[model samples]
Target: MAGLTKDTPYPTEIKLHQKSRILDITFSDGKTFQFPCEFLRVYSPSAEVSGHGPGQEVLQTGKKMVSIVKIEPVGNYAIQLNFTDGHNTGLYSWDLLYNFGLNQDKMWQRYLQRMDEAGASREPASRASTAQHSCK
Candidate 1:
């Protein structure tokens, strides 16, 4: 919502691969990006995840298996991604998407660093092995 401009490259194609848990998107400028569901969920631009301002970002954990259940277009500027985890507030604009595609690697590294610093794991807690237990 902050970066969309008149020159922003709009999406030409968008495909969701359920089995692979990837969103493959192609922009009007011939750039294609494959966005993993977990990455998207962790990096969601919604206020709930990104917070209302700087230094208020909430670190998302246990979302490695999250998936996009639906995609809805918002007029001509953006699209809303409905995640399987019930998150659906972020309006991913063309500019934001393009920037994400271009900076994914750097952003991903930053995310990993943050996660490590916070001692967080991306694996969902519900999926943790039942083999480990404490004696009563």
Candidate 2:
């Protein structure tokens, strides 16, 4: 991942509200965004979710209740979010986070549309489904 650029908006404050499952972040540009945990998980920058190239993106399901358990800074440019669902690969950079904040509504709508088309549910899968997907 690339480091901060001269034009990147640096985050001034980052707070995770566990009860609300929201990540509240403020940038040096004086803009603040409150991101729901589910949104971040579904739109993760990790290759596992985003894939190595276009058209290979994996649709993340059963993450409606996922929350950030920990936020670890990766140098000065990004932060690694350790989620309750055991996802910790994505390195959320300042620019990416800012973009997510800016386009949250549109992105969320797209996600919902995709889910609807796939006949998927945001709710976590049941034990039977989990067992079906487990390794042999």
Candidate 3:
């Protein structure tokens, strides 16, 4: 997959709410998105989170109370998130962020389906499995 570059127009602001576990981002082009902590947790772009193959993806569940503790810049292409629940590996690229911003609904639905298949609940705050994987 292609990552973003310095010229890539990223969001102007990215606010993390510790109490509500929400990541509110406002793009420079006037688009605003409020991605929930659970949403961001489930959609983490880290190789540990997203699998290498399409069907190899592991479902993330029980992250409703997870909060974003930090947003560190990774070069000019992505931002590394430090989740309150101790997940700090994901490197969210601008392109991936934009795509997630656009396909939130569909992706969320798919996540729910995957959770159901895994007999998981979305209400708790459990640590996602650390079976190393990639999303390429």
Candidate 4:
């Protein structure tokens, strides 16, 4: 949403590949991108993830298996992605999503580097496994 105007390219079709954990999006400019759910969740544009100021970003961890549960349109500019983890605050604008898709490889590598720097693991929380064990 930052510095983006109505001229920004919007998605023509958005498809979810549940098995592959990919979101396939095609823009008005004929560019298509496949974004992994993990990538999208970790790079969420919400304040909780991106923060309001520089150096304030909260590093997202244990989100390797996160998924998109739902997508709700936001007016005429963006969509609110409801993640399986219940985080739905981010409004992913058209331009932002496109940029993310375009630079995903580099961004993903940067994310990996940052995670390693912080000793963070991409493995989904072990708490879910523990809870399942307790229920059995």
> Could you give candidate 1's per-residue lDDT for residues 1-136 as a string of tens digits?
4576777889999999999999999998899999998888888989999999988899998787799999999999889999998999998888888888999989888888887788777777775453232211
In order, the Cα lDDT scores of the candidates are 0.86, 0.88, 0.77, 0.86
Off by over 4 Å in 1: 128-136
Sorted by TM-score, highest first, which candidate order results?
1, 2, 4, 3
Q: How many clashing residue pairs appear in each of the predictions shown?
A: 0, 0, 2, 0
Cand. 1 Cα-lDDT: 0.86
Candidate 3 lDDT score relative to the true structure: 0.77
Compare candidates 1 and 3 on TM-score and give the better one: 1
Q: Superposing all C-alpha atoms, what RMSD in Å does each candidate have to the true structure?
A: 5.1, 5.7, 6.7, 5.4
Q: How many clashes would you count in candidate 2?
A: 0
Q: Report residue 41 deviation for candidate 2 (angstroms).
A: 0.6
On TM-score, the leading prediction is 1
Backbone clash pairs for candidate 4 read: none
- What are the runs in model 2 whose C-alpha is more than 4 Å off? 1-3, 127-136
lDDT of 2: 0.88
User: On residues 1-136, what C-alpha lDDT tens digit does candidate 4 reach at each position?
Assistant: 3567777789999998888889999999899999999899999999999999878888998887789989899987789999889998999989899899889999999888888788667776785453322100
TM-score per prediction, in order, is: 0.90, 0.89, 0.82, 0.88
The candidate with the higher lDDT, 3 or 4, is 4
Q: Model 3 — TM-score against the truth?
A: 0.82
Superposed Cα deviation of residue 62, candidate 3 (Å): 1.7
Model 1 residue 47 lDDT? Answer: 98
> For residue 49, what is the lDDT in candidate 2?
97
lDDT of 3 by residue, 32-125 (tens): 8888877888888777788876776667767755778788998866788888779988888878887788899899888877776776766553
